[model samples]
Target: MSKWFCILLIACASAHAAPGAAPADDAVQVLNDKSLLNQIVELQHNVAEKAQSKLSAVGQNVSQTAYQVADSTAELVISSMGFLGLPYRRGGSSVETGFDCSGFVRAMYQETVGMLLPRRARDQAASTQVIDKKELKPGDLVFFNTMRRAFSHVGIYVGDGKFIHSPRSGSEVRVENMRESYWLKRFDGARRVAGTDAAATPPKNY
Candidate 1:
């Protein structure tokens, strides 16, 4: 009777021990779940950091471009104003050799703005954007008909309804008002030079 009781106790103990020894697959599954969760959390953190870096870079580029545009415009105005007393040559286009009416306009753009305008005043007008006299701004081109022909003369508008130009053979480069009788009578049109690798491409709002 005592031996039968001992065997029964041992059998009960063995049954409980069998459940405590878990299967290998169950243990592996728990480990895998923890690893996957950790990986997901790390990935999200990296993506957020990269997004912030890209946004910062884009903002810096826009600010730099805006500053460059303002700088170029100011330089163009200063360079044009420097040639106040140069003589007018028939087909001259540089400060070193003087400038013709069209040449003066062309040289100012090339020297200050670093753009080569079309040689003829008429072609220069045609190549650029046509604007009304009322919309004239500094660095814009103003056309005239001094020789009884359209666009026979051209000058650079220098704000305040005034311009700088090389008038004729006997005259020198000078600033004159567009309101003068001779210029006002011959005013054909106004045009702004097209962006040719200078002025940062202006932003167009949608």
Candidate 2:
């Protein structure tokens, strides 16, 4: 198994400490076997094949930013996974300083895809292309009304009904099930950042 996969397993092992919560082994299986990792590989392969064929046919007409390939999206997901245990900090956006919900999402997009998103959760939601829940793919943005306001929190969707984010103060960056009651009720909407290239649109000033 890959080193990152081991790290993910370890993180999941420690993630569910509550007495009635799902078993750590079960969480590990859900995250690795049933969800994110496997889905990423499949998504990458499928998109790579499609991109190759389309590129051969259209040549220069294809805009890299206009249509994102799965490779970049997979990279984004893997990159975010590397920070699984990073601490949360309000208004923070770095390893040293930690990250907030929106800050974590912004940092991932900026670092991996060269896309600079709006700094706050609401602004990020307003700026991106609104997408249906059924249309959500790896690397898309998922918003939540955690603070009793629409789009008050944000995370990077990593497939299989899960998303990764810096949850709140005292909570480190972690992946959570969107199907869970708390999150399910608060889900505001989903959005997609269309570009994989560095020339994505500039973030609007908040």
> Candidate 1 at residue 132, lDDT?
69
Instruction: For candidate 2, write residues 1-206 as lDDT tens digits.
Output: 35565565456345423333334333444455543566655554666566666677777346343246455776687677766767789999886688899999998888877789889999998899998787777788999999888999999887778888999998777788898999999999999886642121212110
Off by over 4 Å in 1: 1-58, 196-206
Question: Which window of ten consecutive residues has the lowest lDDT sum in model 2?
Answer: 197-206
Model 1: per-residue lDDT, tens digit, 92-169?
Answer: 887557789988888777876778899999999999999766666556788999999999999986555667788999
Give me candidate 1's TM-score against the actual structure.
Answer: 0.65
lDDT (Cα) of model 1: 0.62
Please give the clash total of every predicted structure, in order.
0, 0
Candidate 1, after superposition: displacement of residue 90 in Å?
0.8
Best by lDDT: 2
